[model samples]
Target chain A: MIPNLIFILVFLFASVLFYFKVRTIAHDINLGKPVEIRDNRLMRWMHMLKVAIGQSKMISRPVAATMHIFVYVGFIIVNIEMLEILVDGVSGSHRFFSFLGGLYPVLISAFEVFGIAVVTGCIIFLSRRNIIRLKRFWSSEMTLWPRSDANIILITEILLMSAILTMNATDGILQARSNQHYPVVGSFLLSGFLQPLFSGLPDSTLIFIERFCWWFHITGVLAFLNYIPYSKHFHVFLSFPNVYYSKLEPQGKIAHMPSITKEIKVMLSGNIDYNAEGSAGEIGQFGSKDCRDFTWKVLMDSYTCTECGRCTSSCPANITGKKLSPRKVVMDMRDRLEYLGRNIRKHGKEFKDDKSLLDLVTSEELWACTTCNACAIECPVNIDPVAMIIEMRRYLVMEKAAAPAELNAIFSNIENNGAPWQFSNEDRLLWADNLEIKTN
Target chain B: MDRKKIEIPVMADLFARGKKPEFLFWVGCAGAFDDRYKKVVKAFTKILVHLDVSFAVLGKEESCTGDPARRAGNEMLYQMQALRNIEIFNAYEVKKIITICPHCYNIFRNEYPDLGGKYEVVSYVQLLNAKLEEGKLKLSSELFSGISVTYHDPCYLGRANNIFDEPRLILNSLTGNFVEMRRNRRFALCCGAGGAQMFKEAEKGDKEVFIERTEDALRTGAKIIATACPFCMTMLTDGIKYKNREEEIKNWDIAELIAQSLDL
Candidate 1:
């Protein structure tokens, strides 16, 4: 009863902490304007199911997908065992679902199998990062902290899996000894291999090991739950909703500025009517200057980034060794959001700062994008770094008139010559000017 | 000035005569102006006439489709330009459009609809593929059997619009020796000319994007590089020139290849 009371208190404390962290993230996201991504509910659900739930896009790279699917599936399936653990924790019972007789062992054994898969997947990923050193992991934006964050998560999973197997192994030996507490649960397929090693231990020591493993596993899970909100692993939760809310248009379409369109139309119509139907949203600024200026979907995209560098790797500019990396752009945006969140916490939502997102994302990086949609297509979770890049470009071009000189010339040419060059529209048929061709 | 000129019907003139063509040929900014891409326009128009497909050019009545302006982040200019072009289209009651440049095709099909300009837009490759499948057009294929050709997937046509099969179908039917680069379809690399990069010099990088893409094309061991987009044509042509592969490798628009192979 005492242990059960302690378990309840710990669980409550962890739950409260996790709730507060999630609330802060939601608050940060709410600081931005709403994006109209709610259209086509059926299509959105289909996309979400295919990309996030089914992990279909992850399979584009089969080797990584194989390892990732194992880890992803294991993370979810093993957590089912959490239900039994929670029941046992609160009720002061051993294998609380053991009353199911034949079915109970099968479930526990399946979880043990998943735990083993998780360890194998994590080890493979760890080696890829640490030993084999995949180039994506070592990219510029993956600084010491980000690198350590990934390694820590992988190591934590492996350690957690080991603890589960150890706990099961010790419990099996205790049950063999016919202890009063350790029930004769069915043999766990993976963890049963460790039982012979602990067979020589006395009943009292086995009981201590079993109780210690139980507490450790429960505490570890609670800590991991809180840690997710702070780590890149937040994608594990956000990828589902992010994919659901992803852009469904043809990939070529840069979102048209409806507000700008209204302004242009009003000017074009020569102001015949003093009042016109302008855009519903405020056309106060041309483009994004800060996190709050970005759409909520863009903010959510930054948060959903796994920092996997798939977007960066496939980027044409990045491939040619340009300064722009899509992964870095996303990470910087997320960092900026965290900074804003902290500022709002400290000095309230009205807090102002001189630093803008532009301070981190340079104009050169913005200009380097070919707008080829490679980065968007390559992202497993559908995080569109291009949206932020183009949004910032709008800010530079419209707000400050700070576009590159050549682009300025091109714009003016299109405005006057009806082309992107200095050629005359009267000579538009220059291609056919000196050629004989059959015509209808 | 020794070359002879031929008459191409302008939409305004046709409209004045109370005639409407089945399709509007959107001779984009590049098609009308860029010398290299001008040939692409002629070649494609040649095929349209060869198939006796009724099409009319807007000629001087046409203007920028606001693709470059939109991509360069000048939304006001893009909207103004787009609004003007839409007025012309509406005036002529254009029902269908055939766009040779993928950038123009993308903007016309995907973006112009948001600004109340909607029409059935087809890329030239899609039209060619349709004609090929419908048996309206035929290529002997024997004329280019020994000439190894590889296709460079224009990003706007491929990844942007998911148009990987149409161009391949056209090329496969035309060239019996067609091969794919290592990165094809959704994974194709961009020519250095997108996002207003054609007008401006490249940003600081270890190498030019076109040079890297040219290296990919060279690796395929195909002598003829077939392109669909006008911008891709210019960039790849420059890439071939820069690598001094001009004497060995030729970058031709897919329309030119079809026109040549069909003995037109």
Candidate 2:
């Protein structure tokens, strides 16, 4: 009874701590400006179902897709068994669901099968990342912690699955011996094979092993739940909502500010005196300088990136040896947002950080993008990294006047000649002058 | 050689004579200034006249649609150019527009609507396909017999605007046998002229993007490298020269192929 009370209090404390951590993340993302992706309700739901739940985009690369699906299904389906574990912990009983009679053994056997699969999948993924050194996983952005965080998730999952299997095997042996509080049951196929190893153990030691395994499994799960927000593994929770609110417009269409459009309308109406007043007051700044200048969806996109490096692998600029890695752009945004979140939490609402997202992602990286939409297309979670890059580039040119020399010349040419060339409007018809076609 | 007579009316001239034509032919910056692209402009104009499409040119009144400016992050300059063109277009009450350049087609069709300059715009490839569907233009299938051609998709027309089928439809109507590069349609590589990269030298790289894309075209062994956008024409032409295969493979715009096939 005392142990059960301790278990309940610990579980409650973990849940409360996890809730506050998630709330803090929500607050950080809410700092971004408003964007209207709220419409198209049915389409958004369909997109989530297709991309996230169905894993439609994952299959583009067959090997990774197959291996990932095993881990995915195992993680999701095995959570049903987790509920029984939770109940057993709270009630201080062993094999609490064994009351279901025939159904209980079937469920345990299925859990054993999935547990083996999960371990297999995790091992393969860890080996691929650490041993094989796949080019996608070894990009410049995958520095020490990012690399280790992935390994940690995989290793923790393996240990958790192993603990569950060991607990079931030892408990099965003890039940067969008619030990106190151990109910006899049919063999769980995979766990039953391991029963021979614990056959000679005394009852007290066997009970202790079962109890240790149960505690380890539940505590590991709680720890993993808390660690997710600080890890790139946050995609496990964010990918669903991220894919749901994805942009439906044609890929090349940049977001035009209606506020800017209204200002342009007044400027073109010939009522505003440009030379006398010198400028339109409301015309204001054009693009994003910091995280707050970005749209809320863009903030969500940064959180959704899996750091899988698929975008960087497909990027033309990255492939051509440019310093622009699309994956790095997303990681930098998240790092800056985390920095600002930490600042506000420590120093109250009035705190200002001297650093900005520009310090994280450089001007060289911003200028290297071709705006090809390849990164956005390749992202499994539909994260639009190029959209964020374009917004930053907008800030560079509009506010800082930091465009390259050739672009500045083109801008001047367009301002004066109404074209990207040096030719005047009077010379526009010169191409057709000597042609034999009839002209009026 | 006797030049075929064709009638091209300026938008201002038609508006002064109390005449509003069916469409405004947007002669983009390349069609107006680039020397080699001028021939492509003439070929497209010849096809439009032969089909009896009532189109008028903005001529000196037409300014650049400022696609390069918007792409280069010059929002202020882009807006100024867009607003100036919008004012001219609304003054004449222009309703429909056609252009042979994909950059102009994309800007007019996609970008202009956001700037309050809404007009029905179509590229020459789309226009030619629509004319054929409407029975307004006819093709002589025997015009170019036994010629193998591979079509290169311009990034703006194919991926950006989703006009993949229109170009293929026009290609199918010609007499030449059509083949595809390994990467075609949505997965097609860019010709490296987009996003104002054509204005400056390519950033330091192992190989130029166009050269990479051209190598894919050459592997197909097509005699003619077909293009729709002048930018693709120039890039692929340069790519062929770089590979020293200019004598073996020639870049032909889709409009030039259509005009020749129609015997216009």
Candidate 3:
């Protein structure tokens, strides 16, 4: 009864804290303008299932993807055990789901297997980040916080998995001793292998170990849940929604500005409305200067980046030693959005932070992009860094008129000659002037 | 000045008689103005005429498709140009378009619909593949029987549109000797001309994208580089020139290869 009471109080505290943190994140993402991505429900759901739930794009690097899928699947399947643990915690019932006589062994064994797999996956990933020292994890964007954040998540997961297996191990031994209220639950296939270590412990010591593991596992889960909102690990939850709302148009198409389209329509109709009040959401600037200027989907995309650096590794500009790192583009946007989120929490919704995304993402990085979409293709979670780069580039070019000189020259040519070249429209026929072929 | 000139029918000339051709041969800015790509326009036109496919040119009525403008973030200019072109296309009631340039093909096929301009658009490679499949065109295997040719995938046409097989199928059916670069089809490298980079010099980099892509092409050990997009043509051509492989390596549009290998 005492254990149950303590469990309830701690769980309530963690729940309340987690609720407010999630609310803060949602409020911050909502600061951006609404976008129409909710259409095509069936298609969106299928995309989410394939890209996020299935981890379809992760296998571009076969070995890393295979290891990641084990942890990803383990993370999901182990949560069923988490549900049973929560029930046991609340009711003070040991082995709460032990009623399924035949299935109980199978379920506990599967949980043990998954727990071991999670530990193994976490260890391999931790070594890759620290020991092997893969260049991707050490890219310029991954400073101390990101580096430590990745390590912290891995270390925390290893500890949580250890607690779960240890709990199962100690519980199995206690059940054999005919302890009161300790039912003879089925053997945990993987954790049973560890029973020898607790073979001869006293009843009071065994009980202490079991209770400690139980508390540690539950508290660790809650802490991990709250930690997700602050780290790139947030993608574990956001990837599904992000993939669902991915831009469904042909990959080559860039959406034209609707406000500009309306203005052009008004101009074509020869209606003189220069003095009239602009329409709602008049779009004061031509493109994104800050996170708010971007669409809600883009803001969501900023939060979904996994910082795996696959996007950066596949980038042509990065390969060619250009200033652009698509991964950095997403990370910088996420950092700025986090800043805005914090400011709004401290102040109010209308809080103005003089800082902009441009300060974090340079014009050099923006211009260096070839808009190749390789980064988008390589991203395991469907985060589109190129789209954000282009959006910011749109701001740099349209608002500041700060396009590179060659682009400025081409823009003038397009205005004057109706082409990117300096030649006139009459010269458009020059190539065909001496060709002997039927045109009509 | 000592070259033979051909008579081309303008859309206005045909529209005055209340006539509409089956396809508007969209001679894009590059195909119309770039000297190197003029041969591609001529070659594709010859193939269309050889197959007796009814097509007409907009001639002077056609302007830039504003692809570079749109990519360069001059959305206003892109919209204006797109709107004007749509008016002309709608006025002529154009039903279909074929172009040798992927930039025009991409903008016309993917983007124009958003601006209230919608029409069936196909690149010359797709049309050639269709023509070959339909038996409207035939190739003489003897033309390129012994010549080794490798096809470079234009990013806009291949990756952007999933058009890998059409050009390859045509090249394989025409040249019996067609090889692939290490990075071909969806994974193909950009020729560095995309995103309006063609109109501007490349940003500061260790090496040009085209030069690296050219190195990929050279690794394939093929003498003839068959490309579909004029932008790739220019970039790869410059790459070959940069490497001083002009005497050994050459770039030809797929249409030119098909036209050369035709039974006609």
Candidate 4:
């Protein structure tokens, strides 16, 4: 009864903490401009299934995809065992699902098999991060915290699987000794290997070890759940909705800003009074200046980014050693959103900070992007870093009037002469002039 | 070279004569201004005149599609240009447009519809491939018999719109010597000419993007680098010149290659 009470208290505390943190994240994302997804609903759902559930995009890199599949599938399937663990903890029982006769052992044996796969995958992943040191994992933006964050998640997964396997191991030994609590169930494939280690121990010690593992496993699962809001590991859940809400238009298409559209329409309709100061108070907000300026989908994208660096690796500018790293751009968005989100919570939504997302993702990094869509296409989670960069550029050019001098010339040339160069529109058919040479 | 006269129809002139062409030839800004890309426009027009595909150029009335303006974060200018172009297309009652440049094709096909300009926009490669498959166009293999050819997929054409197979199929039909660069199709590297990069110097980097892509084409040992977009054509042409491989490597647009193969 005491153990069950302790379990309830721990579970409730974790749930409450997770709920509050997740609410903050949701609140922060909601602060962004609400985007209207006017795409086909079926297509969106299909893409979500293919990208998030199927993980279809990860298949490009065979080795990493293969290991990732083992880890992803194994972790997901083993979490089913979490259901049984929850039941056992609440009732202060051991293997409560064992009443299913032979089926319980089959179910547990399957989970144990997957648990082994999870452990193996995690070890290989750890080696890839630490020993082999894949270049993507060690890019300039992948600071100490991010590297350690990845390691912590992998180690935690391995440790959690260990606890489950160890718990089953001790439970099997107790069942073998015909203990009152642990009913006689057939051995699991994974945990059965370790039964002999504890077989020599006394029943009292075996019970203690089994209970300790059960307590530790439940507590660790709760801790991991709460850690997700602070970690990149939250992608496991956010990826689904992020993929669903991602744009359906051609990758090259940049979404038009309706606010700008309205203003332009008034000017085009000759509604602008040139003499009047041009909406001076509203001049500050044009493109994305900070976290709040990003659309809801972009904010969600920041949260969903796993920071795997596939986008950066495939980026042309990044490949040529340019300042732009798409992964870093997305990471900065999340960091700024978190910083701003915290401030908003403490000082209300209207709190204005002098620091913008551009301060972190410099205009230099944003300008280096070619708007090629390579980064967007390469993102495994369907995050469009290009969209964020373009939004920031819009802020720089439209609101700040701070485009590069060359581009400013290009803009005026296009505006004045109907092309990006100094040539007149009358010179458009000069190519036809050469064809006329045949007549002479 | 054509000493023979071929009449290039203008939309204003054709419509003035009460004759509507089947397709509007969108002579993009690069197709008009760049000296090298101007040849692409002429070659493509030659093919259209040869095959007797009814197409008309907008001539002086044509304007920029604002692709560069939008990409450079000048949406106000982009919208202004887009609105002007859309009005001209509407005035001509244009039903279909054949774009020589992928950037023009991309803007016309994808972005223009949002600004109330919708037409059956087709890239030259797509149009050429369609003609080839329909048995309307034939290539004499003797023209490119000894020359090994490789294709550089333009970012606008390949990754943005998935117009990969059409260019490849056209090249394959023309010559068995056709080869692929290391990063072809979706994995294609940019030619350092996108997003207003052509108008400005690239940010500090170890190697130029065009140089990197040029190495990919050079590594293939293919003599002729076939391109579809004018921006890509200019970038690769400069890349070849920079490496002093211009004599060995000829950067020709696919339209130019097709025109040559047809002996037009």
Lowest lDDT block of 10, candidate 4 chain B: B1-10
Give a tens-digit lDDT track for model 2, residues A283-342. 567888888788888998988887988889877677767778999999999888888877
By lDDT: ranked, best first: 1, 4, 3, 2
lDDT for model 1 comes to: 0.88
Worst 10 residues of 3 chain A by lDDT: A431-440
Whole-model lDDT per candidate:
0.88, 0.83, 0.85, 0.88
Model 4 lDDT tens row, A1-440: 98888888999999999999999999989989877886799999999899888988898888888889989999899988888888978987777888898998899999999989989989999999999999999999999999999999999999999998998999888887889888898878779999878888999999888888877888998999999899999998899999999988888778876666666766777777544555333444878988888899999999998889999998889999988999999999999999988998999978987888888998789889988788888788899998898898888999899999999999999989999999999888888974732321
lDDT of 3 by residue, A1-440 (tens): 98799889988998999899888778778878787776899998988889899888887788789779878888889989888888888997878889989799899899778888889899999999999999889878889999999999999999999998898888889888888857887677888888999988997888899889988999999989989999989998889888998977766778668877877777777775666665424547887899998888888988998799998887778878788899898888888888998998888888996679999898888888777677887788877786787777778888899999999998898888888888888877776665664333
- Determine which window of 10 residues in candidate 4 chain A has minimal summed lDDT: A274-283
RMSD per prediction, one decimal?
2.3, 3.4, 2.7, 2.5
lDDT for position A13 in model 1: 99
Query: Please, what are the lDDT tens digits per residue for candidate 1 over residues A310-336?
Result: 899999999888999999889889999
DockQ scores of the candidates: 0.60, 0.45, 0.51, 0.59
RMSD of 3: 2.7
Evaluated at residue A203, the lDDT of candidate 2 is: 90
Q: Determine which window of 10 residues in candidate 2 chain A has minimal summed lDDT.
A: A274-283
After the best TM-score superposition of candidate 3, give how far the Cα of residue B124 lies from its true spot, in angstroms. 1.9
TM-score of each: 0.97, 0.91, 0.95, 0.96
DockQ order of candidates, top first: 1, 4, 3, 2
Clashing pairs in 3: none
